[model samples]
Target: MGRRILVVDDEPDILELTRLSLVREGYEVETAATGEEALACLRRSRPDLVVLDLMLPDRPGTDVCRVIRTTPELSDVAVIMLTARGDEVDRIVGFELGADDYVTKPFSPRELGLRVKAILRRGVEEKTESEHLKQHGLELDLSRHRCLHRDEEIALTAKEFLLLAALMRRPGRVLTRERLLEEVWGEGIAVTLRTVDTHMKRLREKLGPAGDLIDTVRGVGYRFRE
Candidate 1:
């Protein structure tokens, strides 16, 4: 079967529209109209990606996003926030909460579809690269999407793994924020430079002592230590 997607939105029109658009893209689409229902659906059937609306009837989308991130079973699920709010703070909050992407309310279904495609495509690309990379006692099994710090497994979100992979693939080369954005998040997505900073911080923390491998280049960007 095609990749599955769960679209959560209180508006019936949006739920139907998003389902239709995604279905046309060959995705298996399911939807929920409330946060409670969405969580229930998630427990029953895990989707590859969730197109979540920020404003919901029963709960704020941020809460739901947080739940997904904190739930071990749901940590790998990609989320794209759909909201009418376009404020920078809202965007920052969404990203900080582990949203994979954010789309403003007045959005084109085609564009949203493309964004979903990009996110999913990136996930696939990550798995097909070089099988293994080792540096300073950190081991990354790119094909298996596993990371090890001195033989102890380190759990990483999809974004965190990808960001680390991008840096390691070009060790010693300073990757500007814009370059990392394109390499890790893909092109044409609505994400800010600070988003890179947020993921990098989390990535570093997860890497533990190996965190120092990723060096900050002051105002320019980050580079994996040579």
Candidate 2:
């Protein structure tokens, strides 16, 4: 089967439009009209990705995203938030809640499809790289897509896992925000540089004291401690 996608939106037009667009791109598409329905669908079966709207009738989309990130079985599912609100704060909050990407309302379905393709492609590419990275009490099993701290499992969203892997793979190398964006989110994705800062902040917080290993090089960018 093609990559499965669940598109959650209250608007019938928007929901069908998104489903049709993704289907045209060869994804098996499902639709949900409320946060409750979306969560129900999620619990029933896992999709490869979710196109979640920031606003929902029963609950906020962030709540659904929070559930996905906290649920071990769903944490790795890639999510692209759809929002009428273009505020950076909303985007940052979505990222903090573990969304992989966001598309502002009035978005082009083609661009959304591209974002989906880029994210899924990145995942497939990473899985092909079987190397494991261990350092500073953190271990990344690239093949298994797992992160561990001192042999204890550390839950991370897909972006967080990939972002840390990028830094850990090149310890001590100062990776500028632009470069990190390319490596993590891929080229031509419409996320801002602040998105990097937000994800890094969340990554560090999740790492606890080990977060210190990711050193911010002031304005230049960030590097993993050597």
Q: Which candidate wins on lDDT? A: 2
Highest TM-score: give the candidate number.
Answer: 1
Give the per-residue lDDT of model 1 (tens digit) for 79-196.
Answer: 8888786785455445578888888888889999999999888876765566688888888898788999989999999999999988888889899989988988899878998999
Cα lDDT, all candidates: 0.88, 0.89
Report the lDDT of model 2 for residue 59. Answer: 93
Q: Where does candidate 1 have its weakest 10-residue lDDT segment?
A: 87-96
Q: What is the alpha-carbon lDDT of model 2 when measured against the actual structure?
A: 0.89
Model 1: lDDT of residue 121: 83
Q: What is the TM-score of each candidate against the true structure?
A: 0.57, 0.56
